[model samples]
Target chain A: MAETTRASDPGTGTATPDAHTAPLSEFDRDTAVRRRARGEFETVIADGWSVFGAVNGGYLKAMVGRAVAETLPHPHPATVTAHYLTAPRPGPAVIRVETVREGRTLSTATASLTQTDPDGTEVERLRVLATHTDLTAGPDEVRTTAEMPDIPAYEDCVGMDLAPPEFLRDAPIVHRLAGRLDPDCVGWAVGVPSGRAGTRGWFAFADGRPVDPLALLMVGDALPPSVFDLGLSGWVPTIELTTHVRALPAPGPLRVALTTRNLAGGLLEEDGEVWDSAGRLVAQSRQLARAPRG
Target chain B: MAETTRASDPGTGTATPDAHTAPLSEFDRDTAVRRRARGEFETVIADGWSVFGAVNGGYLKAMVGRAVAETLPHPHPATVTAHYLTAPRPGPAVIRVETVREGRTLSTATASLTQTDPDGTEVERLRVLATHTDLTAGPDEVRTTAEMPDIPAYEDCVGMDLAPPEFLRDAPIVHRLAGRLDPDCVGWAVGVPSGRAGTRGWFAFADGRPVDPLALLMVGDALPPSVFDLGLSGWVPTIELTTHVRALPAPGPLRVALTTRNLAGGLLEEDGEVWDSAGRLVAQSRQLARAPRG
Candidate 1:
């Protein structure tokens, strides 16, 4: 469903099929498909009207990596930091990528996406840094992280859940990857594309659907809280997401062992490490998420 | 020497002492020390009468952590992020720290400092989050990191000839722990408190002046170029510093292995893992540093 901009103001008017009676399409107007010779990925966005309560910062970051991979390299890793200048959209935007360096051992690339109003005023801008490197056996540093906490299965978790847009049902990939979101339980995750160092995966929800790589990344942003949402209960919307993939594991189910380090007076943070099927450290992510709730 | 304000409007004025020219005896007047104890760590301020060509966001972050440590735990590791609200003072300002959580394994804290106008209007605000944890040799989940990079001696770097702060020159602890700042070179470091798991030595300037922990932290922050700065002739200021100390090594001669993972467009990050003489991993750190021209 393409949004029809009011010919007068591009920012006004939605391309909804019906004013009030129709359900919106799963493939909303913001959905666009990128078909590259090497790789093809589809992108869907919110025009500031987030599927979740807030615009998804992690989704945009993961998309930048995905977009770069189309013309760059596969099975690559990236360390991305996106400065959220403005809230992203649920509508279509352009993602452009350029190669930076490609050595035998490593490759680098840059990506940016932007959205503008009909008058050309900017709405969003996203910059990404990604790298692809060869897999080599290291001096063999290995550390076994905490065990995955026992939690209800996905089926049971789904039954107990309640939240916004139900786009997750179609994105089972993220759920299988991130697993259940039990703040109190440990999540066990491992990297896919095994043998490559520094890669990890998690199960998450997307637009209320099962989580995939992008969704998992988007929802995984947790930080210590402040007074911004002083009266709120639970985690705050993540304002930013910075992640690094250290190892890539073989394609398989993974586990992410998560535990909260501290939360008090409306601020909290957690220490999470992702492991591969063999229990190897694929990646370690520590986010300054919002304060855990009562 | 404290500034004395008359009974005037909050927009009042008073003669503040020259922070730099003041003797060490009046150490409280040093803006850096005062800021470390109570100023904003990092913020984006509208250009004004500050001294540095570019306002330093890095120093604020490091200093805020030090300020928080006074009220938290000693020698605790912190992973903090400061959202740049406004540019910081090239002049003087105060900082404040708060303990958010004091857990058994870790402690969480927040610090914020505001820079104000002579009229007491706000200029900028810095928010910081720090975490402290007790070290334990739990179950042997062993993992090794990349072998330490090989480099030259402390005396060989290009920056050595450049002038360093006089305090740095007199502080044998900084020299013994981090070596003189030259260009990219490897140096040996150890905790000042011998037998502790961290690098040690008395680092304050030659005159036995009070030391600032923020200064001590930066000593070990000297890292080689991120691949981005490898061929470029410039320097980068870190935007954030995240340090994790697993165990306190018996303080004595400690070693810091520094290396860089370069990003495109002069964006770079550095990672360092500290080890005891026995090669036990004492702590590790990652910094979001900028790439600056030499």
Candidate 2:
């Protein structure tokens, strides 16, 4: 009955009466925005893109990135930072982008994602500042001191979609993407905990869509909080997140490593690095978030 | 002749006509902002707090932080991200702050530092988004998996102020603060590049002022770019910087470690960690900057 209902569900809408029509990729469709006016866009915060009732911060950032990318002359977001003012539910949202500075090499813009409350009051959910540039035209020099995180091969890792834990069974977002966690990093899933603060995994869209600069934002925060490995459980809300797109990712699953260094004064800082299948460092992110209750 | 004129230099202004008067610490006086109106402030970007010709990014951030802290109910800036639109020289500037959200545990604000150009056009130099809260009221739990960067004792390190480098002699900002760098990290100074991208040092104000939350902002970007150790040269301009204040520093010189993990496509991401004398993590920062023209 569940599988039959999913076929006709309006949220997925993958099966239509007209069998000849093709459907959009989940990422592209959910992140799509329509221009309302000059520098203004409207989009819906689609279902199944949320965690623990609130829309995922990175997914919201990707939506804003799409709006900012459209308004700028550049083709990609080079560096972006978003501050979560308040979490919004699955509903309609308005993104307003303002050009801060448009240089020949790089252009900077500010975007605000706002949603209206039931009481007819509009509240801003997320505020973003991003600089966009054409990655192909950027300098070709490559030098890196950071190494790609060492993790088990995709086939050797534990597939999250195969059997998600009880707590994550209600999280539709987890099912939307295919993820494989490092065995050592998932000790907390069992009765034993690692007592460390780090998570390494490989990720790709469930629909096998190609990842782009905008998609990198979502990948940055897609994993479970690193603190979970240390036996801490609860929702870890991000206060501010910053992502630097180092290069356009190559095809294939992206490898990600999230590590928390300092957890003090009720706050913790998590640093993440994403490497493409080609073993190229594609993106880096750091976020400050409130510690979990437990 | 230079010694005789130093006493009357207005930039330092430590020697005044009234010898009995005490002077404000450089960190305090330089970051001071006067309220001009509601949610508005005016402050000067002092001359000594600059590198090359442009004012330092961290110093500018500290000044903007002061304004944001004043308007919010919170006392300390918990997390702040600043995007440098354009580097401003030493001059008077205006800071405009707006309260975005005032929650029970945290308050969020946005600040803009604008200065009038010689053409009489007002230009925004720096834009910042910060969340503030009282660190003392935060959760007492502490869990850290990151270890402090190991370096020799402060007395064994190379004092940058003792024999200033030729390139740094003109940079007054270096002299305003005393720094001792690890010998291994300063191989680039003598033309023997280490081929590594890391720098560890001890830092404190030249006037012996205690480091505070605001000063941590300056220390985040105080050291020379870590790429210098890799034989890179030229001024590395910061595009966007995010600093998380984990805790207030315990009195004494700060132990700072700056490391660049990746440098690609004419941009690099540098991560910094600041540990106070009490061996507590005080701040963590990550910045995306343009690669130096070597």
lDDT of 2 by residue, A85-149 (tens): 88798889999999988888888998899999999999999889898888888778899878999
Q: Write the per-residue lDDT of candidate 1 for residues B77-155, one digit (tens) a residue.
A: 4344443334465555556666644545445565666777889886434545555543342333333333433423323
Instruction: Give the best candidate by DockQ.
Output: 2
lDDT per residue, candidate 1, A1-294, as tens digits? 222211112112233347377553332222334754333344566443233345455556666666765566544453443433345655666776656445454455555667767798754455444554433422243222234435444344421123223644433222212234333221111112121112122333222222223322333342112211222233253423455454544333335544333232232333345444454445444443434343
**Across residues B1-294, which tens digit of lDDT does each residue of candidate 2 receive?**
132332222223222123256566677788899999999999999998776686889989999999998899988888888888887978899999988889898888889999999999999998898888899998778888778889788778886765556657668776667678999899888788898899999877767667778778767799888999889988899998888888988777789999997888999988899998788989998898999998
What candidate 1 gets wrong by more than 4 Å, as runs, is A1-43, A46-51, A71-74, A98-104, A135-178, A182-219, A222-235, A250-253, A258-270, A289-294, B1-173, B176-294
- What DockQ does every candidate get? 0.03, 0.77
Poorly placed runs, candidate 2 (over 4 Å): A1-22, A164-169, B1-22, B163-165
Best lDDT among the predictions, by candidate number: 2
RMSD over all Cα atoms, model 1: 16.3
Chain A vs. true chain A, TM-score per model, equals 0.56, 0.91
